[model samples]
Target chain A: MEHRPMIALVGNPNAGKSALFNALTGAHQKVGNYPGVTVERKLGRLALPDGRAADLIDLPGTYSLDAKSPDEQVTRNVVFGHQEGERRPDLIVIVVDAANLDNHLRFTLELIALGSPCIVALNMVDLATRDGLELDADQLSQDLGAPVIPTVAVRRRGLDDLKAAMVQGIPQHAAPLPVHSEHAAPDADELRRKAREIARRAIVAETPTRRITSQIDRVVLNPVAGPLILLALLFVIFQAVFAWSEAPIAMIEETFAALQTGVEAVLPEGFLRDLIVQGVINGVGSVVVFLPQILILFFFILMLEATGYMTRAAFLMDGLMARVGLSGRAFIPLLSSFACAIPGIMATRTISDPKDRLTTILIAPLMTCSARLPVYTLIIAAFIPSTSVWGGIGLQGLVLFALYVAGIFGAVVVAMLLRIGVIKGPGGSFLMELPKYQMPLLRDVIIGLWQRAWIFLRRAGTIIFVTTIILWLLLSFPKPPAGSDQSLVEYSAAGRIASVLEPVLRPIGFNHEIALALIPAMAAREVAVSALATANAIEESEDEDETARTLGERLQGRWSLPTALAFLAWFVFAPQCLSTIAVARRETNGWRWPLFMTAYLFALAWLGAGATYWTAVAFGL
Target chain B: MRLTSLEPNHPAYVESIDWNAMSEMDSRRLRELGLHEGASIELLHRAGFTGRGAYACRIGRMIVAMRAAHAGAISVRTGAE
Candidate 1:
């Protein structure tokens, strides 16, 4: 294989490096983890003007060569060629924000001092001009002794110039530059001073126009109104996840039913047909139907992130987060956890404090990830009537909101305990930059939604598909003896396992069916709903009427109101997803914290379910 | 006066910093943002009436949000001085 030249894009956080990468790569991007670390390594193929392609690695954003967080450390290691399992880049493209030169240029100066073959991408020049500042790119290029290309990443402006500069900076078959031994790393103070000087010289004209970001922040970050607006936005988001996804969820459900019916009509009555309809179609479909909700939630998150309102949210949340023994910096990660805990825990790299990061990781799963939506919505639809609670609040949406509140309440209590106990220390200081607000680009949001949707659909095809088959096999084996009134499920391998699990979960209102589902659910929380659908579909295979009913309707017939409520309570703290646990381990760099997280969550799940079950039962619900 | 005590829109220059009051990491972060002796700084906005929580300030041209504790460690002199 021919060795492709490697070029790395580096910059400070929120310098529009990702947007530039998206424009350069144009969907030829691969996101994975570096060896033994949870930090994401994003690689793309950038086609140079000379017709040869170069491998572009987007390094984590940093402030200076001096490492602060894990992200910054990775950037430093990659630049110095010390990162394990990563090749040294043949050239470095240092991206700087044009409007914020004094801060961004410090990192640019540091990277330039490394003596690496480099080019400067003065990105977001349009925003700079909009803010009433004019810059001479030639002056900056001369002072830095590098090629400077002004570009606006979102609009794809000046990309051709940037590509030409890259082609000129790196020769064909160029070798990675050896780290400079002569140039000792200057302290940050010195770099800042030099950066300020170069930035002043580059400015041809400046006008003092009020920044749009500050003006928006005046209202968005208002101490009183800010928090209320955040709450309202959150309430609307949760409600929208339920309201907006209903039609799509129905379409998916009907499509799967049709698919199952089609398979039944074409195939002869046998085991293979049963597996196809029950295991793959019904099982995976139960999980896949929740995709609309996940995408809606992710759309809002990606928009908030793209528009740079996420940090301002952190600022508003700082006070409330402080009361829970966390800083505002943890708020972003915790909020991301609502979409999924995997990315949420990974986002903890921005937190500089070790205890803070660990505590945030430990409580991340309590944020009611989108995975839990399947289980929550399934149970909610089965038991809760969709009627007007008050003026316009549906009982179903209110229950969904209550379940989310339950997760957050549990997290707050657990965080307080963890802080006062094992992770005892003074709270870490919160410090962060609130990036300028901009309209979220449509292309970027669509790309992000595509990635999330693909991950979900792929999981349905692979993990959930295989697990359902294995579960189907476990439920189908050792054919029941002739005329044995016992259902096939009760006589199979899964039944024996559930019988053993039943006693343990009995006090928490879990029945034999729920116990069977719990066994497969450990792979992924959404599998609980799929597992039940699979098991029920298998058991009712002979009865056309029972099989025709939806999983929610079937669940309503089998489970009491309290049992359904207990199941909801159980999921609020259940660390049932294997991916979340795996990511937690990788992030914490050991099994210790992950194991602690699992044990505590299981205990809480049991207690919470027991509490909810008994309370509902006593009330005659 | 401490940077936290400075009112919004009042531009000041750092006179001295009680680096001892901060963790090694915190001080390094502040320095990386160009908060040092004689560095131009301004109090942009404070979070609430208590004058606590996050204190948004401008160091050079960068807007930074820091806890009041970190802001309290930096003493500054206004242009009036």
Candidate 2:
């Protein structure tokens, strides 16, 4: 039996490791969860020139082997064969940024210290050359005592050479280098000195690129103009989300309406018919309608991240964060929250300081995640007038922007309070390496957006789908009294529960309809739209106007402008999603912080809603 | 002298690093600074808030951070001559 070697691909964050892996493995890749952790492990087999297959594992990106974060720790463990049941990699392929070899070499040296057979994949050579970088591949290879192959992972450049190098089995030579105390167990000074000496012999730069990046950075990264640019970018993105997604959203809505009508026409008027048409179709439709908006949000985020603007944005925001006693490193995790709070909360592990991590966890949920897009869209579409100002800033976009701003403000306030009250510690320093700007790989951007969309749909199909069905059953069963004109729902268990809860919610502007919606919204905020559709008997209607007219008429004389505003206000601060709470619990390592977060958000929502309602009544709007 | 006061382009030599005085993580970070006893470093650039400054310098093959306080500690021989 021929024994195949195991190969590991490693690089810095967003260094095209995945793209290279995909290029090499193509359709042979399988993605699975890493044992007990949620971190995804991508493994595949690549054919060697000799016709033998080698196993390839694409490890998570890490800055160095110091293992500051969980992702980094996992990478460290896997590469060193510390992970249980995992064989040590026969060869380590160090993916270096050809454009930014200075930063990339830090990891290279660290990996060299591990004494693994290694090859350097100089990725993004195209970008490096475009930026006027020159590299003598042979000289670099000779210097480092390893084969150096130039590769453009996005363009699939030098992949064959890389494969050939791997197949040839590059010799492992331990170069004399300085080992920092943090890296190994002993001889820190000696090791670091040796590492420097090796670097002096191996690495050579034609011209320093930092000066150019810094010169460009002065203008774009200026504190005053930088924030303005950031705000302008965000405003444009929000506007685009509403403008670009409108047609697709309308198409989805119409498709679902047509499907609902078809189902109602074919099935008999009974509980099963209603369950299929009104419950399942409507429930799933409500979630699906928000997909375009979610995709749009992700598209812009990926673009911004790809363009290398995110690091500058984080750098600009560092001063403000320091004022509130939070480190700038919290920016990435908090920004991730805009897509979903679960991963956002989980990403807080990057912060080495425990107190800073907790502070970041507390504020992450306030970053208007994609899940809240449906609630915001539903409320804004129903209440806010559709108009444009200053060329094409849509009114709906304006409202969405305001809601995002409100969430950000709420998060900052919460962070400030937490710093002063609970986890008080001196603010630590911020250190980050800003990479050179490069055009994002379309393949990676598309894959990222696809993964986000799939995750959203999966949640809807599983948790939201099951919860909606249960809710429909609860609101449909326990038939109404005979000879009574009341709908069957008025006598159902859900109706009784809402009626009992109505008194407590009435002062805050919640009617039975909204109250009923809230119960299912707890499962997922977007489900409230489906619940409202079911309760109003609007899902079975053939005409859009009939459904809209009935819902509008039912809510017409009952809800004042203040009541609608109050409802919007409530959702802005409402802790309605259970997944967020569960994630918060896991991130914080106890129920204490999640409980406090839920309580504060709930109280804030109620107070804000109550105040809006009363104030609207006073103004007679 | 604090690192915050180091003039851009000036060369500095680290005399010593008191790893025990810093937090474990901060100490680890200091070790990565390439300042382990007699390494020569230069301040390449500084842009951001003056109070909590963010600087960039080359250490081995990496451009790593040198906090204002840490930067100040390295005794420098000005290259202006």
Model 2, span A1-621: residue lDDT tens: 856678999987656788788778876766655664545678889998868788999998776776676677778778767766566677889887776554456667667666667898988887767655677778767756778899998788899999999987633433223233343543444555554554455445555545555566667666466667877987787678779988898898899888988987899899888888767888777777778877887788778777777766666667667778787678878877876776677767667677888889878878887667766666676777789978999998898888888888988888888888888777676666566666787877876777677777877788668877887889888888789787777678887888998997899878888888777777777776556766776644654445555665555556667877888788878854777887777666679989988888888888878988989889887
- Steric clash pairs (candidate 1): none
TM-score of each: 0.92, 0.85
The alpha-carbon lDDT assigned to residue A527 of candidate 2 equals 72
TM-score of 2: 0.85
Quick one: RMSD of model 2?
4.6
When only chain A is evaluated, what TM-score does every model earn? 0.91, 0.86
Worst 10 residues of 2 chain B by lDDT: B72-81
In terms of TM-score, the best-performing candidate is 1
lDDT of 1 at A199: 92
**Docking quality tier of candidate 2?**
acceptable
Compared with the true structure, what per-residue lDDT tens digits does model 1 show for residues A371-425?
7877887788779998996698999989988988999999999999999998999
DockQ of 2: 0.28
